[model samples]
Target: MVTDLQERSDQINSSDQNKIIIKEISIESEDQNQKKIKESKRLFNEGSALNNQNKYQEAIVCLDKAISINNQYDFAWNNKDNQLLNIIIQDMHYIIRINTKKQFYVMTKLYLLILNMIPIGLIRSNKGILQYN
Candidate 1:
């Protein structure tokens, strides 16, 4: 009857309204995700700039913020790792340089002591022979 037709029409309209609302929500979600990605990228760029300026600690803070915003951000994670590694490498080089200097100092002292134990006449003779060679 006409009542049945009216009821079916109401159901179709309600379903269509639901679809439209769902679509709107989906669009909003996409927009929010885009905004998040954009913000994360901005933070990442700041971190990279700081890194280039040799402000490693500051760069790491920025990169950490980027990563927190987007946990899937590979670039932020990679940069953070690189910064940490650079710090470790620099520390290692400093240690090596210090050790090398200490060894050189000890070796120089030993050389001077050995030289002093040798007679001056023998040293002079050997220096003359070395010059001829």
Candidate 2:
């Protein structure tokens, strides 16, 4: 009868060990998910700052990384959309200013000045509006 009791106790212990292992795995996975989310938020905020500075390509890259890390990041998506709209508006302003005769040279010089302020290695032609390289 002692042998029979020992066999039953060993089976119970094995099951308990499996439960502990499963719980540990679950906790580790949760920690990794939290880290990814935190990184995503950081990237999104950086992208927004870059966007404000008119570094469109760099900003898009950062925002895309944030979205890839966390597909449910709505703020990143919104900011990306806003950046695109700002680019469009910039282009429109260029085209409108180009059509004016007296202000064309002045606007072109102003545009060049603004472009020079951007740190990115992009150039825009006076007639090309917001085209970037």
Candidate 3:
């Protein structure tokens, strides 16, 4: 696992190097700043170790950090996962049903809420649009 992390880290370094080259050639947007993948890899390796020792909560924290860095990481879900992510689906259902507005309203609000709470981007207002908040 550590070896894997190191290999991944090397890949990230290459990616970052590429980014640096891009920035040198063209103007980069704020959103274009690649995450500091170094720290994320360290966290991933630590979490993997914790998971092997059956420290689930600790592992989850580390995995969550890694996910925050790179949401596409399936490795974060690998420690002790069930095929069913029922809890997440249940939460989504409850969020929609609780505010039983129109279907579109419910779905929009559900996504907005998750975006607001999670590090995901918000879908709603800056100057109080009152559209979905």
Model 3 scores worst on lDDT over the 10 consecutive residues at 121-130
What RMSD, rounded to one decimal, does every model reach?
20.7, 11.6, 18.8
105-131, model 2: which lDDT tens digit per residue? Answer: 656665676576455644433332344
After superposing candidate 2 on the true structure, give the runs of residues whose Cα lies further than 4 Å from its correct spot: 1-3, 97-133
Give each model a TM-score: 0.66, 0.66, 0.36
Winner on lDDT (1 vs 3): 1
Clashing pairs in 3: none
lDDT (C-alpha, whole model) for all candidates: 0.75, 0.77, 0.61
Provide backbone clash counts, one per model.
0, 0, 0
For residues 5-112, write the lDDT of model 1, one tens digit per residue.
999999999999999999999999999999999999999999899989988889999988988888878777767777775665555556657797665655565457
> Model 2, residue 51: displacement in angstroms?
1.4
Per-residue error for 103 in candidate 3, Å, reads 43
Give the per-residue Cα lDDT of candidate 3 at 97.
76
